[model samples]
Target: MLYGSTYPRDIFAELNRLQRELEQSFDIEPSIRGIGRGGFPALNVGSTPQSVELYAFAPGLDPAKIEVNLERGVLTIAGERTDQPGTPAQQATVHLNERFHGRFKRVVSLPDDVDPDGVSAVYQNGVLHISVRRQQAAQPRRIDVH
Candidate 1:
């Protein structure tokens, strides 16, 4: 390793960190169907002229177990993913374990245009979908050419 040289891995890590920070700080992702704040149960956000929608993926859990809350313009999704039936015995050897089971949380800062009072959440097929209407002032309108 050269004294003044930087490794490629270091550069990639730094870039990823900066991108994550931008996404969190601005509450905007590269795309609506893109990965969100690094955490369990990733989400995708999309916006239309009338409202903004959020989709959170959390499979294999009952809807009743998931908690959704909005406070001070921030949306929070929290819950736990527990081991299911036919669980492996304690003495069983595990070759690969990719599932995440336990408590998880994700706080998404809502855009200023969203109306907190108009927010609604619905969980179906292991996905929690939420929608918040845009304020009248924030909606885009076409103006007549004068």
Candidate 2:
């Protein structure tokens, strides 16, 4: 539905339609993670009365090599994953390779109510955790009258 006709039978078209539906049902920002939309690294976004939290899963990467930036409410995570060396220097080839390496950059559009000044991120156990407080004026409050 997103990019192909119903009878076109293109794999990418089906994927696009499925991705759109999933995003709509899950309230997910588009192209948030995985190789289909882009490549490497993945993230999850959540919200609370006080803040919005982002958890990016990136393993086998140096924390120092990773970079996170926010501009105009869009977050960008970029970094590279280095491959491990072979034990004997010449015996590490053949069958299958599944893990991803090299550099990747992902951008996520954030909610307008997020307070950029309060954003913070930390990489731990292969997950980059970010917390951005919601704008104080946007939070709900209760009022009472006598």
Candidate 3:
């Protein structure tokens, strides 16, 4: 231990704190795919001219238990993962447990022009995919003029 010296771990923790502060000051919503906040089921969001696509990467989860909803231009995904059998049992010596096992929820704001009734969700190969189609009037159209 030395005076006026900072440890590497402390420096990184401080940097993370500063980043969170800056995001709050700028009203920047943290993404569900970022670290430090422990957002479960890391997400990938993208959009096309026709629809908005979102993918949640969650392995070892039952597709029937996942819930997806869209209301008032907002999308919500929530579910729970049961604990595995490796828990501290009478003869089990657990060393490292890094997997997420619990209830998790994520919400995303959608564009105003999205059609609420045109949303669809499907879970396959441990990934949950949700698509929200844009309104008809919001899509670009070709116009001919003299």
Candidate 4:
């Protein structure tokens, strides 16, 4: 068989096509812990007796651009990630863009025991850590008996 015309001229494009086909064949499911579509910025949530701790892993972001909100026992983290700089006149072709880009938001439902006024958030080293202190009345306390 003749070869020149049938061969793929763009190696990167061919590889990307193959990768997409393989992923489709495997029937993979998107997950929050992985770099799947719609699951930008993986999250880890945990609770302790005194407070609830939530950590969001999102790099290459401006701290000022992030918006954190807590209302009615719901916590929301939202921000935008700008795409990497490109070649002049948009001539660059991205071979692979596994990292998420653009606007993303993640919501979490908190327990009723959490105090609305006792929440704090800090973003450092590409990790946003949020702590919500539990209500004092809801915390465990030793009761005296006669």
Best by lDDT: 3
* Preferred candidate (lDDT higher): 2 or 4: 4
Whole-model lDDT values for every prediction: 0.71, 0.72, 0.74, 0.73
| Candidate 4 lDDT by residue in tens digits, 25-141 | 574432222223325577888999899999899898999999999999998888777665763325655454355555666778899989989999999999999999999774588
lDDT of 1 by residue, 1-146 (tens): 22332434455445545654465457553332223444567788889978989999888877888888888888888776777766652446654344556566777888888888998889888788999898888458899998
TM-score to true structure, per model: 0.66, 0.66, 0.66, 0.65
CA RMSD of each candidate after superposition: 10.6, 10.8, 8.7, 9.3
lDDT of 2 at 31: 67
Candidate 4 residue pairs that clash:
none
Candidate 4 wrongly placed segments (more than 4 Å): 1-38, 86-91, 138-146
Which residue pairs in candidate 3 collide? none
Quote the RMSD, in angstroms, for model 3: 8.7
Backbone clashes in model 1: 0
Worst 10 residues of 3 by lDDT: 1-10
lDDT score, candidate 3: 0.74
Which residue segments of model 2 deviate by more than 4 Å?
Answer: 1-38, 87-90, 138-146
